[model samples]
Target: MLTSYTIAVIGGTGPQGKGLGYRFARHGHTVVLGSRSAEKAVPVAEEVAARLTGVDGAGAVSGAANAEAVAQADVVLLAVPWDGHDELVGSLDLAGKTVISCVNPLAFDKRGAHGAVVDAGEGSAAEHAQQLAPEATVVGAFHNVSAVHLWGEYDYLDEDVLVVGDVVEAKQVAQDLAVAVTSRRGIDAGKLRLARVLEPLTAVLISVNRKYKVNSGLRISGLEGIER
Candidate 1:
């Protein structure tokens, strides 16, 4: 039998990861919050259940270490940071899975701005991840969403998520997950190669938010009518 469309948030104990985990659970999909340490993920999973207690059709969420969680999960969200990206990618068996990458490669010091030192030559973090996990259909998403904003009580009444990937079906799965979290619509920003643009844009947004001391997000006004 085919597995249920359960979602797994690898490294999902953190802000962005937990946010997606909570969203997925609230939408009634079983969510496994995967972490480097399963013990650490347990508290985070409990927090997701507490935060989303009142949502309709909500289901239970659990925790596990990364490898174990991904093995049984249908949709996998890669939420580990740039520093651990390579190591995390190397640990997975992603054949035929839909892997959504929510990472941005940034190198910044306390005093200044440093750009990403990319490994893919193409400079897109998502591309690098996809190259490492060739059998998985990798898609770029949630790059621009601030972790703080994501974990907080933002209604996200309507927002825009830039979804990028080479495979159409993979991108659609990523978009479906995005919509479950918000009334926001996800716009397919074309092949994962375009993630070169999206990833750096995240750094720019970080710089802006750091200077402004408020949540900063990119939202496009005209996308709601297109209906993808």
Candidate 2:
């Protein structure tokens, strides 16, 4: 397993990105919160670092513009909204990096949330990312995990992260990192194609949360002592 990593959260000013950044930092991995501008991300990074004060095993936290953050990171997590997903991702030079996409393309309406139709026709954001940056190894994960619980006062979340990728080595890297949030290895949900299911599943979780007024997450069964 990799001992340490410099993780860059692309949409770090947002709740999901900030929450993930907090978790990674808490686990002793360097985290850089990235936004369109460094000015927007710096204060948020400061706020996250402030919250980790006196916390054991916390790593260094910083902020930068998206491109700068990606340039410095070993692993990059895309948590930006779907609207600008293409533009932002296409703009970055992500060659030879492990890119974890947690962005869910979904449209919210009066009825509820549902998967948005992707223009790339790749079925999910992860696949779209793969298309845009073919040189980078793209993995799909953290789609269904709760942003609230991640940044909340909880020590660790009780959930299973489903990681999908065409590359086995890259997938394992993401699985190992899952312990930072879920306190367990991420389940190898299958190839990058499966992201179609995992991405849209977030909408179902959101709907469930609204109905039950709880932060719902996934828990896989029958995998006891089974390593993926």
Candidate 3:
């Protein structure tokens, strides 16, 4: 049975966030497209609603300010860039909510994109988020999925999401949401600390995508018939 959840994407006006909002809404979850500018968020939600017209719960999306969206959601996904991550997350009160972050700490240069060495003392961006929202159950996920593929019109999304968190149920909530989006598999990659491993791997995927001119993602093989 699929659990119906109300999800709020904090950076939902952006490509990654909009794509996720669309997917969740298509699957009957109430999706809130949150942004610093509520004005921008509205149109993004409207567009998602238009795309999801024939879906089972097409009208399940809306837009709002970041704080408002967080207030209404059963779960919150952070898709904001790393530059503004700390400030944006620090301003919110996410106590008692399932907060999922996919922010990869990376930087681009003339050469190519590379993972930024995290100096926050916490290891990764997800850990930084965990520190920002102490009362919230923070789970790291969606780090390696491509924004382009996420918003593409493919019949199904074929990829794997690595979900990591200290809390058992919180990780389950993150995994459930991952599966809710599409046929993609969400694997429990262990404790919150493992975010250190998953975050930088995104940079490697980016490098590969650029080199091959493909929107590639992650897939851990050798595990056959793994139960979700």
Candidate 4:
């Protein structure tokens, strides 16, 4: 299974994955929605295509396995779970491409994010992915974002993106992806090392969700608006 990577969403079968795939496709990126099964991926890609502004509502996209998608994409989005995270990174061919890691590393039974993968140096899932995918420029982003809200519009969720990556080009690609989806902007938060802090925020947000009983997000208020 291989989806071309002009821009591809790996694990696009999930809710968050589909939302981003849809948003990026809407922004005119020739998107591939990656899944374990190509047949399963087709419908999701078609659904995203149906929403694009200028694209024929009948637009079609490619789908394939994780590696094939990454191989072809200029940029790749990783929305896989924590368990699959390192495994995928270890197997990917990231010679010159920008990699986006969108994992939160939270363990849950029913309530949600009850625990985290404590083995990581900083216990950050995104940082772990950055370490595993050293060859690729790993950027940390979209961990706590609500895909349901991102897919449509939910007043509770604000869309500012925090881009963290060691490589400037990769970070910019991440920023572009973020800006394309949300009405808000992307802020480069230095290097990928910072994901140690950002990843845990997923757990923190979970605690907030438990306390407030709602999906919540962050918004840094004073920066002037910037274009993608």
TM-score of each: 0.91, 0.97, 0.95, 0.83
Score each candidate by Cα lDDT.
Answer: 0.80, 0.93, 0.86, 0.71
Decoy 4 TM-score against native:
0.83
Who wins the TM-score comparison? 2
Query: Can you tell me which runs of candidate 2 are displaced by over 4 Å?
Result: 119-122
Steric clash count of candidate 4 = 3
Clashing pairs in 1: none
Candidates' RMSD to native: 2.7, 1.2, 1.5, 4.4
Evaluate model 3: give its TM-score: 0.95
Deviation in angstroms for 96 in model 1? 1.2
Cα shift from native, residue 186, model 2 (Å): 0.6
Clashing pairs in 4: 1-65, 5-72, 5-73
**How would the candidate models be sorted by TM-score, starting from the highest?**
2, 3, 1, 4
Candidate 4 Cα errors over 4 Å, as ranges: 1-5, 53-60, 109-115, 153-157, 225-228
**What would the per-residue lDDT of candidate 4 be over residues 101-216, giving only the tens digit for each residue?**
88776667676665474564555666666677666677888876877676884322455788887778777777766755665447887877777777768777778878998777
Cα deviation at 130, candidate 2, in Å, is 0.5
Query: How do the residues 28-115 of candidate 2 rate in per-residue lDDT, one tens digit apiece?
Result: 9999999999999999999999999999989999999999999999999999998989999999999999999999999899999998
> How does residue 68 of candidate 2 score in lDDT?
98
Question: Could you say which candidate leads in lDDT?
Answer: 2
Candidate 3: segments with Cα more than 4 A from true spot: 120-122
Query: Which candidate model has the greater lDDT, 1 or 3?
Result: 3
